[model samples]
Target: MALRFAILGAARIAKPALIDPLSENPDASLVAIGASTRERALEYAMTHAIPNAGTYEEVIARDDVDVVYIALPPAGHCEWSLKALEAGKHVFLEKPATVNEAEARVLVDAAKKAGKRLIEAFHYRWHPLFRRAVEIVQSGQLGELVSAEAEFSVPIVRNAREFRWQASQGGGALADLGCYPVSWLRQLTGAEPEVTSAHQDLEPDGIDRRTTAHFSFPNGLQADVICDMDPEGGRKPPRLELVGTKGRLDIDNPLAPQYGAELKLTLDGQETRETFPRRPTFAYQFDGIVDAIQSGQPVWTEGADLIANAAAMAAIRRVAATG
Candidate 1:
């Protein structure tokens, strides 16, 4: 039986994150959509070829939906995800899973108690480029990792960026973009790191336009992460850099490697470049989601992993406030 997906909101992210993947995943089907209003849902439904459209509550209660893809704003994520879990539907939530760690804990607990597969959709990690990096690092090919750095930045003008992202509303460089580097470091390191020091650049409204933090992992691998949303700061390639005892690895645009990233590995003074097909990151991610549901396994971004990422983000803010 195909797993039917019902979108929880008419969010802009719904297309690349869920709908497009639904169209490609054989085991998944787009059955319905529930937005803040029926008209909005209906409009989105018509645009996406989804069959049913209605209010949020009505869609969750439908027998046709076995899964709920939540594309709501950060504030609404926790509430709606919990509701979906309580309604006996698996949840695929967007990143920063919740506005804070407290809500993440609650929502994760609810998913566990409900015995449903809850995934925090960190789409970048699912891409082959990132997966290959993980393999190299884990294969001992990286050879006793020494340190690493990952950065994601976009140069949207302040006015354009601030309109939707206020710190109070869970909008900031760190919350919105920093989570990726943090999670990437954690994934590659295979252990949680301590936030040794942190800094933030804020707007008049207290939005963190840029945040930089240093972390020290238990295995003696130190790392740095920078998330910048400053327009004047110019653009940055979505990159991750790793240094090990034997050699170094530099990835250009690792975040969306499908779009193209040059993955270079240098060992013993021999350098080689690796490549993966330019399929969208969501393609691999959606299939993993379906496999998790069918096999009764947790997605990579499920359970403790979700809570850990949320807690790490909170720690970054706390450290920045005190530092």
Candidate 2:
């Protein structure tokens, strides 16, 4: 039996990230879509060929829906996620799970008490390209870990009405883009990091347009992240580089490896480039969701992971504010 899903919002991300992937997954089905209004929900459902459409409350109350995909804005994540869990539906929450650690903790606690699964939508982590890159570092072939650096930058979306430009809606480079690198650092090191320093360029609206943060982990491991919404250059390719005592690894565009990806490794003055099949990260993420629901498998971005990432982001913002 397929795991039936109802999306809580007609978010732009739903098309490529959730609807398409769930449609392609044999073990998953896009059962419905719930938007802010019935008209919007009906249109989105018709466009996506989903069987049902309604308000979020109506969709979650339906017994046919087994999972609720909470693609609402960051501010609404905790509220809708907890609602779904309370309604006895598993939740697939979008990244940056909530605005702060406190909110994430509440959501996590609710999930635990409700006995439902809550998976953060960190799609890139499920990609094989990243898995291979991490493997090389963990193999100790790179020697003891030294430092990790990641940069994710994109041209600022000029739409004044966009939620990303609103501070109250959890808008900013740190919440929008920096979360990726923070989560990546945590995944690579298998440890939470302490924010040592942070700098940000703030907009008149008080949201960050660009941010650079430094983190320190155990064993003298260091990580730096750079995220920019309005980069001087056109959108630069996202990159992650890891350095160790004996060797180093560089990865290009791990965030959306489906476009194209390259992983380079240097050991003892020898360099090799590894390529992976171009597959959508969302597909792998959907597979993980299906596995966790159907087979009792655990996913990497569960509630605890979300809480840790949220806490790290909070720490980064706190440091950035002090400067």
Backbone clash pairs for candidate 1 read none
The deviation in Å at residue 27 for candidate 2 is: 1.4
How well does candidate 1 score on lDDT at residue 281?
87
lDDT of each: 0.87, 0.90
Q: If scored against the real structure, what TM-score would every candidate get?
A: 0.96, 0.98
Put down candidate 2 lDDT per residue, 147-257, tens digits, no spaces.
989999998686866888888888889898999999888898788898899999999988999999999998677889999999996899999999999999999998999
Backbone clashes counted, model 1? 0
Q: After superposition, how far is residue 112 of candidate 1 from its true place, in Å?
A: 1.0
lDDT of model 2, residue 48? 82
Over 4 Å off in model 2, which ranges? none
